[model samples]
Target chain A: MMQQEEKLRVSTEQLEGGLGLVAAAGYINNEGGQAIADAVNELVASGCRTILIDLEGTRIINSIGISILLEILDRLMESGGTMAFCNLTPTIARTFEIMGLVQYARIFPDRAAALAALGRDG
Target chain B: MEVALTLPLVPDVELIAARAVQVMGRSLGMTDGELESVTVATVEACLNAMEHGGQTCFFVRVNTHREDGGPSLEVEIEDHGVGFDPQAPPRTSPSRILGCVAKRGWGLTLIRELMDEVDVRSRPGKTVVRMVKHVGGA
Candidate 1:
């Protein structure tokens, strides 16, 4: 069996009000999930308290990916930080709801809305 | 149309199964939502098979069929693993919900929710999960 290359891309930007934006694309399996965790940790290390993930380009995620997100959520909770998700595909939004991640993280329809809800200037 | 693939029990290979479902679903004229559900369900099924199937290789087969009402997509994932009872209490949604914070055990639940029909058959040496989604909502 040929190894399928990991395709998830993660990038972060610091926004006003100490909000950090992490954008991800591609499949969020094990490799993609690890990449996301690393990105969130990096942002947190830089003193960003609130984070919003833009998942507009992400289409598919497995249970492992969800686990990674949960880890990030736990980390944020420990530090009195918050995380939000924006631009979730219909399926992904439903998955998050089912997994109960929505209880801990906020989800918005778009980046602007998420940033606004997080009290950051869009 | 019909397609079959044999993949190693590995996490990254889930992409191949997902892409196959996507392409076949498009060719079968599935709506975007329907296609997305099928693809996700397929990948979830593959992931489960890889993690729990306890086998080195698993098989995925996809086919389109015309039922009495409309066309439907069917996918089957099979593996030679130490199969568990589908009727087991741990498979219930309540148990899964309780364990949500653990970030695991949602694969089977997600597959059941996303697919129109699901069937699981398991024995000591083999396990097979078959799922179907009807097109056109007939």
Candidate 2:
């Protein structure tokens, strides 16, 4: 796992046929968000069309972080790529709903379900 | 007990306030979920101040409260800067078209959603956001 910041870390797994996974741990704050954004951009540049962020080890996400995620999603959608998330805390899930992010990003219960959804995208 | 924090307006400094909320909420016997809610809400409130408020630093006050129904934790974030109308329409949150949220303006929304009671008072030079969360099992 590459440490994004003192309180956050991110690691990526690339699959066959333009699929990728970025599992993150710790707080998704400003530094963490930008780190994830850079990782996603790199994956997309490497020909990933569907990406799933596994947040099983993460539970805290701020609105600024969500806003950064929104920017990533918009850029991905523009390029014919997409993003999804799995294992979000209930509070984060509720906040996502409150922020209207769930409308665009498909959140699943686990990596399996998220992959199933992203597999359809690929 | 009350814990008051003066935070520098820097990137990721909001985490300090979030961590403080965790410590305070846990002392109040709040659940993990409740703690998480307040943590996120506190971060949002702080980020809003840092981003929009014209201040070098801000203040966050955490205190315990007893409501008619149960115990609660109250968080107040104060910023001395340009204030805004809380009742104004979302300046650029889009039209809820299942797309972008204008890349901003969701901080206050998230704070309100996670906290049980939220009150905001702002003027040209000052803004205060006070939010309360019940400990649950009332």
Candidate 3:
């Protein structure tokens, strides 16, 4: 029997000007949520104050996943840093609004828009 | 056709149940938006069962039927956990939900908002959430 593959993956990149990008793919459940939280923690520890999470590859996010995202947001706000989300699906976007995550975090249509809003030219 | 699944009270298992429901809804010709609503509601229900139902495993039942007016889907999630008042007011309001900085307690609200009809019954050692979504405006 084949083992069930984990559904979430997280990868990070250090952009210029102290910006950090954390890209996630697959469902944002317990496993995926923890991966994202761990990635953001590592980036913040390395002095990446401005972080952008690209969620184009992600689709479904449950309440537990939302909680994990909120943890990351709280941490960023505490350190005077900022976080943004890009490429959200319509369902996830509405979920964010209903959960009031949009109140604190910025959302862009795509990674380029988020990067631009973060004061990057490209 | 009706299908029932028993899964462990774990977060990842919730995803598996939700995906199965989504596939069933799609096969019954549910629209994307309707399917999404059902999927979200199912996930929320499963999460509640895991957190509050106090049992190691839960059950989910998905059934499709044609009402007099149209086709519909009904999903039932049950857990053998310590149950609470199903009619209790949401812990947070929209205002507080927007202003407050916490990321919890939105599961019930989302379940009520997304599904067309929701019925919850709870007592000690048993909690069940039943939600219905009418397909294609039915």
Candidate 4:
């Protein structure tokens, strides 16, 4: 048994034109994934149609975490919302590609780029 | 270099082994993308074992040494449980169309894609996933 805080820190920000940003930092393990999923789900449930997840501070992520993201992506689509990601590590970006995630959710270089893609320059 | 640990099947137990992956990789000169790749693949292997092992605990072993090409690290996770057929294809894929997402089954896929080499041996009563990542630029 080991005592460690493999916690995921999550925050939400409202951007222009109904775009919501959910930023997550830390390992996206099972617990961390759930926390992020919950945050995004809340945004979707709150009538937000566009969302971006920032992974700047995250260095490690597993399939459980990816699966959670895919679930949230599905949820967003089902509700006519959109999901995108920014600040992904090269490894994560490759993983998303291999797992066919990028085919569905768009990936931008960073938050600013993602915002610009959504036409939210302000 | 070599290290091994057994984890009791608990929630987020993979973190313990993930720490081992990091410590070993950094100590053995793995950096940046390769280190991150190995760490994540290790976590995915541990998660697969814990999810399907049907056992109280699972094992993780890390070893690093010079290979024919260069230095490399391999992480092996083992569990004694109801193993599945290794020949069977892993069920994973994000649907191109909206409203359809296969949320699960990406663990094995990610491991195979991230690591330089991957081998999974499984059957009833035991399962082992070995993932190898080459050090330095590859």
Candidate 5:
């Protein structure tokens, strides 16, 4: 059997003076979905409206993970806040496109672009 | 034709699902590809049962027969547990209780889409899922 990789990590950094950085690493599946959701919720609760989800390290996402993401987007949109994704792998990128998530959310190539778009200092 | 199976309400639920679809599909003369889809959907249903039903034992009854000379199968998955409301919308955010990461709530929808008929009942101490699949679009 293929080994299961380490799933997720969340870290925060002060950026653009007011904005906060939330970086996520690893795969998103039934095993890792709850942790990711909690991390995102933590960021939102910390008064971070302009959210930047750094997906440079995430590799896979199952349906459960996608639902969590859509939930986050719905919550943020309801509050008039913004969330952006960065450095998505091809598989995940294609999934986002197929789900039409990119239509409402912004995608960036790297942290610099994401922060710039969010008008935050990185 | 009918087949009765009792399965442990653990990870082994998928095995029962596969067997149910296989026996019923064969009785209905379904193509290999069609049988595969039914098997996948049935397994998903069993997983849902295991996840949602807080029970120790589960049972599955497959009732297969010909309707108007076309093959059809109905599978009843029953569990003895305190059932939850299936009509309520699924949680949008990840559930800490389930401890899963990917968050699409399409398990039931997929089963419904794959099958011809889907019925559910959640009583005080038992939950039953009834699913039917028609062969050859008949």
Candidate 6:
């Protein structure tokens, strides 16, 4: 088999309270990391802190993907912002816990709950 | 459309993994988290290929097929590298994976847990991993 890498699609919605709800759906592997990093970076550039990543539509994520999330978390923290993850399945949630990601990012059951925890609804 | 990707073994692994997940998930109707799982597991497998396979060029190929009588998706990611025994020993806990931090070991454990089916073939020259996940079900 030959090696292949590609990015599918990413978009974000502006929620209330300056919170940006970014939903990145697709694969995240060695090949697909840059696009994701760029997506998160785009959110930061828009001056929207308090980011919520909806993993409900996401199917895969590699270490590089984790690095991107970590970087985003760092970016948010540096700017006095926050990041939360929602729609975590058993498998995905376990991966986050094992990687010590839960130490940095908060996990929610879904998007509405995450937003509510952010103290807003939009 | 089934796409194959090849990149030089380098430090930028996650970027590639995300791209693959995008393609597979969109085509198969997988949710965001599911795509994340595939990308993460694929990254682990690719890292193993580069490190253990001892190959200059790493290969990642994905093939998607629908279930015959069910509503689900199956994707297989195969690599061309030296493979290892998947059944060697279960790491027992995720902490062991974090504590050791070995590229191949941790990723393998995570991949096994994330995907419905994880298969590894570690021959001398060609190491392939066939991973399958079912969608649209509880």
Choose the strongest candidate by TM-score.
Answer: 4
Question: How is the predicted docking of candidate 2 categorized under the CAPRI scheme?
Answer: acceptable
> Measured by TM-score, how close is model 4 to the native structure?
0.91
| lDDT tens digits by residue: candidate 5, A15-85 | 65346567877656454556666776777677777677787666444445666777777777777677778
Which regions of candidate 1 deviate over 4 angstroms? A1-6, A120-122, B89-100
- Better structure of 5 and 6 per TM-score: 6
Question: Tens digits of per-residue lDDT for model 6 on B25-131?
Answer: 76888876666567666667766666776766666666676768443444444555566676787553434322233232467767787787877776766777777
Native-to-model Cα distance after best TM-score fit, residue B59 in candidate 1, in Å: 0.7
lDDT of 4 by residue, A9-117 (tens): 8999876688888999888876788998888878766767898999998888887778778777777788877788999999999988877778878899998899888
- For candidate 5, write residues B1-138 as lDDT tens digits: 777777776533455557567877887788755665566456666766677767666777888778686778788888777786779763333333122334545666556655778888988788888987778863
What is the fnat of model 4 with respect to the true interface contacts? 0.77
A101, model 5: CA deviation in Å? 9.7
Question: Model 4: which residue pairs collide?
Answer: none
User: Candidate 6 on A1-122: residue-level lDDT in tens?
Assistant: 32332343567777667787777666555444556557667776887777788876555556556655655566567777777889876656877776666876788999878888886532
List A-chain TM-scores for all predictions: 0.91, 0.90, 0.91, 0.90, 0.83, 0.81
Task: Please write out the lDDT profile of model 2 over residues B1-138, one tens digit for every residue.
Answer: 899999887767887888788898998899989998999889889988897789899999999877688788999999999998999754333455336356667787777778898999999899999999999842
Tens-place lDDT digits, model 3, residues B1-138 = 898999886546787778878888997899877887788779888888888877679999999988798888899999998898877777343454322556667788888878888898989988889988889863
DockQ category of candidate 3: acceptable
DockQ of each: 0.41, 0.47, 0.34, 0.64, 0.10, 0.17
- Fraction of native contacts (fnat) of each candidate: 0.40, 0.50, 0.33, 0.77, 0.17, 0.27
Per residue, candidate 4 scores C-alpha lDDT tens digits across B3-82 of: 98989988778878888888888877888888889888888888889889998999999998786888888899999999
Q: Which ten residues in a row have the lowest lDDT in candidate 6 chain B?
A: B95-104
Model 6 stretches with alpha carbons more than 4 Å out = A1-6, A30-32, A120-122, B1-43, B56-138
In CAPRI terms, where does candidate 6 land?
incorrect
| Best model number under DockQ | 4
